[model samples]
Target chain A: MLAFVLRRLVQSLLVMFFVALLAFSMFRFLGDPIAQMVGQDTSLQERERLRVELGLNDPVPVQFARYVAGVLKGEFGISYRIGRPVDELIAERLPATLELSFVAALFALLAGIPMGVYTGLYPDRWLSKVLLSLSLMGIALPTFLIGILLILIFGVNLGLLPTFGRGEVVHIGFWSTGFLTISGLKSLIMPAITLGMFQLALIMRLVRSEMLEVLRTDFIKFARARGLSNRAVYFGHALKNTLVPVITITGLQIGSIIAFAIITESVFQWPGMGLLFIQAIQFVDIPVMSTYLILIAFFFVVINLTVDLLYYAVDPRLRVHGGAGGK
Target chain B: MNGMENNVAAPVADTAPALLEVRSLRVEFPTRRGTLVAVDDVSFSLRAGEILGVVGESGAGKSMTGTAIIGLLEPPGRIAGGEILLEGRRIDNLDYERMRRIRGKEIGAIFQDPLTSLNPLYTVGRQLVETIRTHLTMTEAQARRHALDMLKEVGIPAAEERIDHYPHQFSGGMRQRVVIALALCAGPKLVIADEPTTALDVSIQAQIITLLKRLCRDHGTAVMLVTHDMGVIAEAADRVAVMYAGRLVEIGPAQAVIRDAHHPYTRGLMGSIPTIGRDVERLEQIDGSMPRLDAIPPGCAFNPRCRQRFGRCEREKPSLIGQGDRAVACWLHEQGEGAS
Candidate 1:
């Protein structure tokens, strides 16, 4: 198991390297950063001086090597627009995005699994039909639209909650989070719902279909014949078997939830990396944009590795050779 | 010979109530075009400690009859018109909860594939203990002990060590033994074994058959053994019921049915068996396959494949005609003075 984890770590590192290289080269092609930084009226010599200061005068390979070396030493170059270290800017916003994704994932699991089990158990019942249709609507409607609709209902029309921005933040060392305050939680609801809606529907459908399939298996029939109660048979036997596939899908969905939060953040003005991303793009801040891209790619690899470990933990069949002992 | 003697002794004292009784049981499956009859007017009874072997070809409805009695028939298929009585109390119409209580307590079921029957996620001991605890009141420690005892009873090597192992750890025959142990652990009055040996090897099949017979005999639990192997019935059953195309064509003491089969279908089945000492150019086979549920002919479902089929056999279905200690569903048998 240790070997397996080490192997995965190496693979993830290779992936992150490729992702960083791609982002670095792609931004260079988007247009000269110095040109975007200086005004058009500036003298040619002033522009040339700015270019030299920024090390834009160097060859492409030399620049890439310098960038790689800087990144290795934990230096993501200063943001051209903000004139601050790109890492510090990202670190300030990291907590919000992390908190939002965590809350959204928790919401999706708590709501989606039960809904899936219910619909899977009784596919023809009226309640199941209604919940299934609602989940379908959740999937069909886009994140930005859902965010606007939520604002209209709870913020604009009902006057029950605030619609835009992080309300308050509590700083702990380098990490700052909004969940420590009541207003922060209230503001979190709309964006979290919008970001979570698609994941909820996807997980529900996955779990429902998987449960339906597991319920028809011979082991389930044997479980029923063993005189287990309907509840025990459904939840204890069928649901347990359904979880492997559900966990796999849910793990993959977490990566998508983070990606999708960009639109939701835009709609609600939530202070997260997603909003920073849009701002960085608008200002042509190549360093910040490239850092964000690499960071998200790194997150995807880590999440996938965690999912593989989880598979070993949950399924005994996968833990045959040395896996059990390692755990 | 021992099985035949047991059969003769079965009816000696007729006062004891049958452990299981099925009266004109019909199971049907509803399809897009129409309802397909899977088990048609099937009726049989099992006395306590008696093994009734139900032998048939594929699609003969033998397994369906067992599933119907156990109330585990897959949906779209149901007991259309029938009564199943256990100790004189009707069980065919029990609700899901009540039926669940009866299963593994009153009537235990053993399916064909051992690998599929046991959950891979759990240890053998856990599954056995759970089933035992569900039907009986016992502490977890006591249940675990009982599970270990059952494993030993089924002849597992080193029961104490093996009980903690998963189902995949056991061989095919060993797994079937574990399944048998599970079915009988609750001391159920009856066991419905559906082709329990078909998935096993020829050598292992005999071992499982003997194990099942010995266990049932020791516990005095009646058994309904559903299989397509004639050899298994001959060795394990006191009485045998021969089914053809969802209907019982013959039922009698194992010796009588094998030696003097009255129905043409049963005769053909016996003839199809290859005997070691007897030499023949080719084994006899029934003319055609069992008819599909949707296309079963109007009269006797077996008429298309029956060699002795007559005008009456092709025009109308024949019900069981009772003789002394035997019954045959054939027009020839209906002509006898004692026919019913």
Candidate 2:
């Protein structure tokens, strides 16, 4: 087991490296950051000097190598326009985005799972029908619209909660621990709910349908024949088999949540990596933008790898196969 | 000996009452065509320590009969008419909760596929413990002990250690044994094994049969064994009931049916069996398939495929006849024309 875990870790490193390399090159080649940086009134010599200083004149391989080395060393170069360290910009904004995404995921699972399980267990029943109708509405309505509506009702109209900005600051001694504490939590709720509604709607439906299919399997029938209680037949046996597909969808949705965050965070003005990304793009801050892109890519790869490993834990059969986590 | 048949059959009816009595049992399914009578007025009784094999091809309603006994048939199919009496107590009208309570307690069932008869997620021990607890009202530790003992009794190798393993860890035969163990865990008086050995390899199939026979004998559990394999019936069954078109065409002692088949369908079935010693061109095949129950033949359903079929055979539906000891359903015997 230790060897298996070690092998997976090694594989993860290789995967992360390739992912970082591809994201970096694509951001560099597809759009010309230098032109965006130089702007309207720049002399040719000045621009050339700027380009050579940034190693833009170097070969693609050399450029990539330097970028990777710099990233590892925590010196992500100065933003071309903002002139701030790219790392600082990212560090400032990442919390908000993560805060939103994590809350959304939590809401999705907590709300969606029971809703899905109920729907699957009792198809067309009143409670299931109500949940289905609610999910359908959730799917149709956009996340940004939901966010706006929430702000209007809770923040603007009722004045119960703060609408736009992060909540009032509370002083704490430690930055690392402080971020996970009360003040941070208070600031995160609105944005998290905003981003979470749509995901909850989508994931609930997937889990319900997959669970319905797994319930009809012969194994479930056997469980029933074994004189297992209704609870055991439905939840213990049926639900366990359905988790594999659910985990896959969750992995895919994490990537989508990141994409959705770009829009949701922008709408809510929550300072997260997504907002940093848009700022980097608009100002053509190449170092900041590239770093943001690679970071998102790294998260995607990491989330999927974690999901694959969880599959092995959930299903004993997959533990024997070498590619359980990889697959 | 032939002239003194009355004396030979006189003592057959003085035996003990049947262990299971399925009286006028009717199972129906609501299909697109209409209400299809899957098992039409089927009635039979099983004796303790006897294997009663029900033989029929697909759509002959053999499986539905088994499912009906266990109350496991899903919706759109229901017991339209009948009384199911186990140990002479009526059980057909019991609600789902009550029926489930009686299911693993009084009666146990093994399905066609062994893979389906065991949940793949749980360990063998867990499943056995679950059933044993449900029926026996034992404590957790007691249940675990019983489950381990059952696994051993089922012939699973290293039952104490291997019971911790999941269903996929065992072979098909082993899985069937686990199923048997579960069925017999509550020490039910009756066991319904529906094609228990069909999923196994040929050699493994024999082993399972031998094991089942030995176990059932030891426990004195009456068994209603449903299968299409005549060989299995000949080898393991004490009595045989041959069904065609949702009706029992003939039922008698296993030896009687194998040696002296009364119904044309039974004769055709026996002739169709491929024997090792005898070489014949194209084993005797029944001329036609079973008729759709919705539009059953005007008179006898099997008359279309029967070679002994006569004018009266197509005009009248034959019912089971004869005294308690001996029974036959045919026009030839009714007229005393085919009587020996």
Clashes of 2: 1
User: How much DockQ does model 2 earn?
Assistant: 0.26
RMSD, every candidate, angstroms = 4.3, 5.1
How far out, in Å, is residue A58 in model 2? 4.1
lDDT of 2 by residue, A48-92 (tens): 998898888898788878878988898887887777898887777
lDDT of 1 by residue, B213-311 (tens): 999989999999999999999999999999988888888899878987888888889999999999999999878788898898977778888776778
Per-model TM-score on C-alpha atoms? 0.95, 0.90
Top candidate (DockQ): 1
Q: Taking the tens digit of each residue's C-alpha lDDT, what string does model 2 give over B195-305?
A: 988888899888988888999999999999999999999999998888877877677788887888877788889999999989788899988688877878966788888
Grade the docking of candidate 2: acceptable
Q: What is the C-alpha lDDT profile of model 1 across A10-89, one tens digit per residue?
A: 99989988888887777766677777788889899998998888887887667778877889999999999899999999
The per-residue C-alpha lDDT of model 1 at residue B108 equals 93
Candidate 2: misplaced stretches above 4 Å?
A1-11, A28-52, A57-61, A168-190, A320-327, B1-15, B276-282, B335-340
Cα lDDT, model 1, residue A185: 92
